[model samples]
Target chain A: MTGTAYVKKIRSGEARLWPSRRPPLTRLDIELTERCNNDCIHCSVNRPAGDREARAREWGAESWKKLLDEAAALGCLVVRLTGGEPLLRDDFGEIYIHARRLGLRVMIFTNAALMTPGLARLLKDMPPLEAVEVSVYGMKEHTYEAVTRTPGSFDAFRRGLGLLREHGVPFIVKGAVLPATRGEMDEFEAWAAGLPGAAGLPSYALLFDLRSRRDGRKNALISSLRTDADEFVRVSRRHGEEAVGEWRDFCARSGGGRGGRLFSCLPSGGSAAVDPYGRLQYCLGLRHPATVYDLAAGSLREAVTEFLPAVRDMRSAGPAYLERCGRCFLKGLCEQCPAKSWAEHGTLDTPVEYFCGIAHAQAVAAGLLEPGEKAWAVTDEAARTKRRR
Target chain B: MSDKIDLDRIYAPSEDIVVREIEGEIVIVPLVSGIGDMEDELFTLNETGRDIWNKIDGSRTVAAVIRELAEEYEAPAGLLEGDVAGLLEELLVRKMVVEKE
Candidate 1:
């Protein structure tokens, strides 16, 4: 009742309800592997070396195909293949081909270390060669390798990207700005722009709090190295001009509220995340049972339509749970959605303070909020205004 | 399958969401969240299906609706029934409405 009223009050300024008014999902994100050559400090799926077999038992290509088919049947137009490294799988080419043949645009997210001339040629031969995005950790060998924690990974990725370019395959570069790579943002952006097919030279920043693998010991290394709120704002403000004009425009228009960059409307439940093991999830970072759904043996559409209402109901009743986040103005800017809640607090709504701080910092950098504005004040005013109106 | 629907039972999405033609595909969005990122999995009704979906307001009986549709669209009633039935089944399954039967 409170959430319903809360949503109604906040959405009153607008002419219609949120989320329920948006289109349902037409995209699927496939995590091809948890195995990674590099043990990054902020990775969520960086399984221990000894747990390789156990992790492998979780999901595979066959399961992936079934999920992809279900997504396609539901009118999914694109599938972004990701993970520790999707290229580690020998059958990556086959899977890409299969999805493309089904009329779905397929994208790959990888470090590109394992990418070879052969794989490049295979992708170039395919007609639906959607852009390949590679994650560059840092500018130099020492800094980049330090973040990835893998020796020689930088050289491998560089060569791999070159192979893709020489073969005339479309690709772009994205970078994670850990403390090690923070200073190299400009260099990485310039290098990415110079790459073939990278006319726009787009890049991304990995929010510190979004490290799903926070439980891992190695993540601690990068966790401490993560960009702090005040400093993060300073860096963004300093380098904001480097972002492409369109991206900046998009960020400005849709960073929050009705016209922001949110993938789905909050609280109204327009979309959800289906995990690697076929469990329906409210967010990718959450591991709780309540937000999980079994999709192993049923119609995908039926499962979503039937089970989603319950999940939405539970999330709607989360004020008793998500106290800190429920009142935060940075809910839109922060990546602390239901999945992130599960990862950090093992609940659907609990707030991870780190994300809250990061969002405020980013907002200040983007000039969405004053530099000294307290997050609580903003949330309180918004809440008070909603109650009064 | 009944071709007519009861408009009273069908709940239309609120006015803030616009369902429009985008290059051939129907693009539906909250009046607030414009065309979303293509990567976010926003689904839309295809053109042909969108045409049929607009008619299912749940006001007409299955038989009467089909007869009207047959004459208006100049298609055979039998052929229209199969497509209409399939579409209705999908719409019903989405919790867009409940069937009387």
Candidate 2:
């Protein structure tokens, strides 16, 4: 009976061996809304802030709290409050305080454009449970407002930071280099370093991928902001050998043998996310309804027990998946996932060539793969899958 | 946790906190009441603080840690005592360290 027990490996210590079972769900990421005060060209998930028709179907505050209750009962310990801007919600305080009271540690992801004095005070008065991730677009107003496309957003951000400072609440400032903010790279890094919590926080984004939602007609804007595959990998190369070494270590303990499942990752087993309209999906970037468990119609328990098992047990089904993504041995390094695939092409199985190019470039640069080796091919696994098919 | 923690109180690190040594600094993450942040969820201890945190093995008293650090660094015992007391006070309030047997 114990011939082959599934093992869960943690960092720096012993790996816990478990019998094959449902993945333990510990964190819940609730996208409070898809609305944002900013209209950044690189954004993948924002609708216009005042688009009333778009928000008509969104769940109200009560529904959100009820979902939080359900999530808490599901053994979720931390609830990440994120969005186009989580601060855009008027009832954010009520929802945040409720989560805290329910014993859920709340982590807020915000743009700082709407962080008011009252909000900062409320957060500071409470015990420092987690970090507030404030997105910093540009150090200067002209550049910043260009990215946000809002006239007074920079002032709001400055005011928000001021409020946090006045109350002595520490936050981490992070940024992504879009076309509009690229020239301010040095200015951004220097400013981020000057922050109180800058020493141990993420301060930049590397390899910004294509729009996760594809945003239909709005894809043009995101693509315009996105650099080419070569440029993306060039930025990623800065991490150098550390990234390669980390990937090597990850694969060894990940339970993925030469021909293991493409996504034999703990994330699919251990975590789940809920989008704005009460649909429970596997991750923040995935919006596949067929794969989602509807929280509005069912309990989290049912979702975990029934829906997640099916999701976890999901196998590659098509010829394309078997050829490229399923058989790829760059398991740790590749960014190809169902979420990325779905976001790029509306299919779970198709490999996004752009991601492949980036992965191959990294592999070549890091000496993991030969410079001319096929980016989308794992020779041995490809042959194995071909025979099996 | 009183504003004045007794000098002789034996304290130990909380089981709820996860301490990891990353890139030289010791990072303490409160995992019991909250989820650790991917970017900034940890409270890192400086070299001195890490040494103190490591010596808190539930068997040692506050004064013991102070004496050990003072001797180890050849610093004044009186100064070390003040620093340790201040740090312990903050940690106690945050519930990262608690009085033990």
Candidate 3:
């Protein structure tokens, strides 16, 4: 079928061929709270200025428990707790324990300023606590604070990282690649690699994209932070093939550090994401009306094998949807999913140019595209290496 | 490297197999037709392998599976135990099964 038709069918009601047989080993991600302390330039989930009180009024502890139990029974081995900042929720620790007791490994993606010694100790005692991912906005206070727009955040984040280290909790640090921080890229990677458990860990930079923020506005800081493609390629090359390989994989899947497409993304039917309100979605990027479900009422297995797949087929299986995304060789490499789709087309399948630019930049650096070629060139040397058997 | 298996590093089936239990066997079908297609590829375990697997399931002590295998096989108990242990280690390395306390 044509890409547009394909996505439509999947979105409409086509069952995902794979997940229908067995429950997923992974639950799509669940957004713990929309309450984030940092007004990051690229935050799609950050509550809009007028809606802060409304959002907080909507979610609470009881809602979290109902969703957690269902996710556990669905056989999700990992649950990534995210938010405006998950730690902002007073009940985050309780939710973590609930999921852990159900045998699910917990990974917290946070800005790190909220980490405390006591929390570190508490986490240290929990074996299911896998890794805490901290996002470093920049290498220095001015640069970091410019992105976070919060003075002294860098210090708080540093102290938080230190607490986790002293307590022996496993944590990894990542950074955003923006105009303000681009010059400090190497220094940032050096800092990430120096963390306690960072050996063999490759620090990655998420490109500053307009789609992530859900607004067409591009931050001037982002413009200046854009790294030259050749420079990134040269720097990544010096770090050895392994480091570059990790970045390459990160691009292919979730730019957020979760195992991306290689594991199971939208098309693969291996994951299901539930929002803070218990609405089910295909991926973190694409939130839709029909695709969403109330976790309080139905069987997760039924949702996965039936309802979820039909939504995927109907929404994303069509050529109109596929014309922008499905055919791109960079499809796997691009982070432009339904969330991005909403940002650009107000729908789940349309492509956004900001992601196109980021992918193009990486494609060029990795030598997957000709110097001036706009379309993705998947047969290039870099593509060949990335697809290594 | 001693016969003592570290649970984190090893994933072994819980039990041992015999000729009678060999009724069904599972194999991983590697799909290497081209690159960029690596995903979980596991097959079913036959009855014999299942018996051996049950013994090695991590809950039972090593001697129990050995005793069970020995009784079922009617073979020399000592040699069979060694063979079963070796086979379990192989499974551990392959990640076909896991070890727990």
Candidate 4:
């Protein structure tokens, strides 16, 4: 009989098939490489795309495949392939196919500069489950090139995006808010809104982080590009009351106090990040020497089960942190996590003043705090509520 | 088209798909061209369908699977044969299953 003759008896649909018991490890972020084709001014983790030494230090496809096998065995269902730009690696397709073969949904973070017809066709044939997230520097060539610093990267990015669209591969674009790209925000938003599968307003990276490697020169450039608290507030207001409402809800849930513990936001052991050199970290931005677990010397299971838990349970003893961020009700609303603190100050617990200013500005805008009033200084809840009203 | 069951013909799962038992449900993800025309790119089976799937070892003939399934459930031989044939045929159309050489 023909295949069509028996079609009516079978039942099939897109349904949730996960077991009731949550997997110990559900998500993994694999940084394929720290190298990128473009040198964006605001980037914190970019190396020269052709840095021979950096390329030599990276694990081969087989090593990455082995990690995927281990991660899959531990019940990882999703793996995000991110990097300075993941497409810089020649073996990206092999690594990607291996992950897909293991039934892990892949989410790619790319600048779209290296997207080729072959890559787009491959993605179209075997979907990544999550949309390929492309970072857009600017809508115009001059503004885009200024941020990326690569002379012809704008055309390359557009060509890459075109390849994705041409092959019917799903993807989305995000922007970096910089002095160079700020003027083109309206243009960027309009263009993004017109793209196929565009969902909601496009997101922008407002708060730029210092270099992960602690390169002083790059950090200086990154700091110079960051918008001040007032500018951040102004740029964020583009979302209007929806953003304010989110902050209000966040405060109501996560406000209050964080005692001495530094990892209140981290889940027990659900997720992990593996860097280019196979060094596993609890979170991506947390590259503090003490917190990084060398995967080459150990296994993913050891890092996930033994090492990450210990790192998460670490508490802060810094007086500056205890006095400011510890008792602050804006702890939930603030981006003053150990990762940000590490990236900014080389310490895990020290509060970054830039993040503090942005958080306080948000609190004031949300009516959760009065202007010039520090969230930590508010001792009386009743008085604070009275001021909020 | 043959009305009679192929008692000696064996069938197996396709290499171009990933079969996973998630949360007690069987999920099949097609590696090429997406999964069974589903927008979400996943194909799932019910309890009975999963039972049939479990018995589709490459070494087992269609008649053997039907016989095993028949003994497990309180069903007639004719009914089991139809059920197994229908499911296999549908899977074949989707390229989720292939006939063994």
Candidate 5:
């Protein structure tokens, strides 16, 4: 009763602060189910939707409610429910309502094809969601289906969008850059801006990362469609200098993280992600077992208190991370991190040259580095300040 | 460490900081710095520090705050004064607190 009343106060903005007048963990990202109907060529982690065994392995609605209750007790205020497609689960309504009852502001991430009339109504009737981020693959039917590889997915996506609009449920549209949708990227953003609740332009991901599970499966087709570092920088520069200006402002305040571990920037050292298998990780792509804690085996209390801290304490493995990424001040401008390293090279410390190339290209474009300057080989005494421990 | 803290000035939390209560502790986020800068550092205040923070509402002098805390906790006023002064100095260095004009 005491905790329930406290949650009520938090929802009404009466007592948002913990008793110590501090907040506990604020956000929990749950990957509901990895089973995606769309077979996008550059897909990073979608196990085929036909895998019944994988679907069976995911934690059910009641378990999720228990976890949400536990999270509320720990002072979690936000829950981001994301997946290959979160709406694939039948118990989505139950889980969503449960999180709301616990006073968490829920954010949903979905491909939008699975969003049905019933779900839209449920979202409308429930308290307004914090955010519902919808992924748009293309501007037309053929282009959309080409990326999703599902023949009628374009129609379903449109229907989903229609339902959200009809119900007046607020949502934002984001796009993935693919060969099929490359030509329509501008049109897509323009249309997204004109949508019901879209704020500015749609944010996009250029470089498609590999599978984080390190499961040894490779998609050469997706790799061929990658927007190279130069193109990424050129496109970014064409947009505006605001991005680079912000990066510079950030670097000025915090010189750079101590170069060793990749996950040091987490909020108050607690922001975490959980996969469909109930494995809690340091972040979305960090699936290394040594760092991943199984919530099914132990309570959320153990995962938060013991396992998370231990994972945070883990050191960088190889010499490259220690020498280059550790001492490098370009983390603000670079995509170098343990998760990306693990995805590209199947090891935590191995450098992903794609990211290095992108960062160098961006550096040159932003006037932070020379035209031919190599990011990894930056030996300039003035540029490469020692990382603060 | 026998120096003095000016007792005449008014002190308060910084304008650009987000004060969060997490896990029975107070965390201060330097918004314009770490957040916009994408830096990963956050400041967490301990128990006595939290108590002192509760009193720094822009209306209290350093001496008044120290005296009030001392009376409330039944501790020596001199010790509380020294602790509050040192805490304020650190907060100033971190830019989490400012001397009000």
Candidate 6:
């Protein structure tokens, strides 16, 4: 072999590979564990870091590897390892390696509190095709620890982030909006912008969801920690005119109601999630007992092919939902989905009033609605015509 | 690096990379370090490159691959040898292709 031929370098966008035809499954979000080192004030799911009962209940390393194998065989190209913090698991490296060996790109979601030198070195050697997302509570010790509720967690997070930086492992930081960290938004944004590999603006979790396990006490704490509608709109607009313009354009293009169909917002097919305990659902948040399939009793193929589509096709028959959410054109603007509803109301169809208020506030701010105008009252024909034009 | 692509050497695609053909084009995704160049996470092959890549079966020597290409395509054996050697050199440097024992 002897001449100077060239290998064309390409970006991911330039390649028409992986799911060139939408395979039945392309992405799988695997919750490695529900445990976290930090007891964040607004977290929806977090078992104690040393909860042996929860640890005992989690599927073993081999079980997870089998699931990853099944997922890869089904044409899954990406597997996201997430949790209260995925790094808490002892065999995180083994599971991560298994997924990568199967040719599935791994994306980790962690609090960055548990990122060690060894883990960072492993990531550097075997890059996680997608960026590891780290959730940042605050920039200062007082504010950060206030949200995490763990003494010395701010320093741990910083030390972990430093290790990732030193080892050249690609990662991005995100923030949560709480009374504790609200004042530090500007600083957080500035720091994130300066960090290498941190793309665009850092996104914040403003409207917190209740626990998937439906812990009422924690749910109440989460509810109290959530930003008000006006505050959400104000904070969101701080991203500047370009972002607001993009939002307006998106609202115009997506203006419509889902009617009685509960899962119309979801993609037609090709995605599902599996919890740490081996229950598979259409998404991580849709933990409704009726919707989740027990993978312990069935295979991944059976769950995705037969069980998931049925759950996705579930319709809302609740009178309240039918009267409001079923007819609201701002459904596209709202974050009120079946999973959110289930987390908040213990039902798949009930409208979350907080989400409804936030959506309306956003709509009004985007100039899509009038003051005091309810979205459900706006006729679809009128809303469509107005938005489309 | 050019001297590394010996005519009698058999080369195979490295185990650290995943290769897939999409719409007739071959895309290579590097699984380990030193394979993908900085920020160029994906590498694609042109028609000529694909032809050469397909012939590197680990069982065939560089000379055999060039001879096979010469018979299939309307090119001189010397020119085909140059093309084969050039591609294998680049792949070798990037660790996308490794010399087999």
3 or 6, which is superior by TM-score?
6
lDDT of each residue in A60-168, candidate 2, tens digit only: 8899888777776665556789987889889999998777666556778888878788888788765336678788888889988888888998999998888877877
A126-225 per-residue lDDT for model 1 (tens digits): 5333568788888899998888888898899889888888877777787787778877878888887777756764656656444453464554654676
lDDT of 5 by residue, A1-389 (tens): 00111111122123434544444467789999888878887777777877899998999988889998888777776688988788888898899877766646688988888888888887776533355778888999999988888999999999998998998777878788777887897788789878875677778878888778665545456577789977786666656887766555544455554567656556452567889988888788887667788888898777876778777766786787877777766777677777887777767777778887877776666555678865545655234332311
Alpha-carbon deviation at A225 in model 1, angstroms: 2.0
Candidate 6 residue runs with Cα over 4 Å from true position? A1-20, A380-389, B1-8, B20-27, B38-54, B66-93
C-alpha TM-score for every candidate: 0.66, 0.72, 0.66, 0.87, 0.74, 0.89
Model 2: lDDT of residue A196 = 77
Candidate 6 per-residue lDDT over residues A1-389, each given as its tens digit: 33345577765433244345555676899988998899998998898899899899999999999999888777676799999789988899999998887766788999888889999998889887777888999999999999899999999999999998998888889999999888999899999998987678998898898887899998998999889989988887786766555556666666566778898655644689999999999889889999999999999989988898888888988988998988887766789889998898889999999999998887787777788999788765455436534
For candidate 6, chain B by itself scores a TM value of 0.91
Docking class of 6: acceptable
Provide the TM-score, chain A, model 5: 0.89
TM-score for candidate 5, residues paired by index: 0.74
- For all candidates, state DockQ relative to the true structure: 0.03, 0.04, 0.05, 0.31, 0.05, 0.42
RMSD for each model, in Å, please? Answer: 12.7, 10.7, 11.6, 4.6, 11.7, 3.5
Model 1 deviation from the true structure expressed as Cα RMSD, one decimal place: 12.7
- The 10-residue segment of model 3 chain A with minimum total lDDT is A1-10
The CAPRI classification for model 5 reads as incorrect
Question: lDDT scores for all predictions?
Answer: 0.58, 0.68, 0.57, 0.82, 0.72, 0.82
Q: Predictions ranked by DockQ, top down?
A: 6, 4, 3, 5, 2, 1
Q: Specify the poorest-scoring 10-residue window by lDDT in model 1 chain A.
A: A1-10
Give the least accurate 10-residue stretch of model 5 chain B, judged by summed lDDT.
B32-41
lDDT of 4 by residue, A70-165 (tens): 998777777999997999999999999999999877889998989988899889998887788999999889999988899999999999999999
User: Tens-digit lDDT track for model 3 on B1-101?
Assistant: 23654323424342221111111323222111111121212233434545565555545656666667777777665655545555555455444455654
Q: Lowest summed-lDDT stretch of 10 residues in model 4 chain A?
A: A1-10
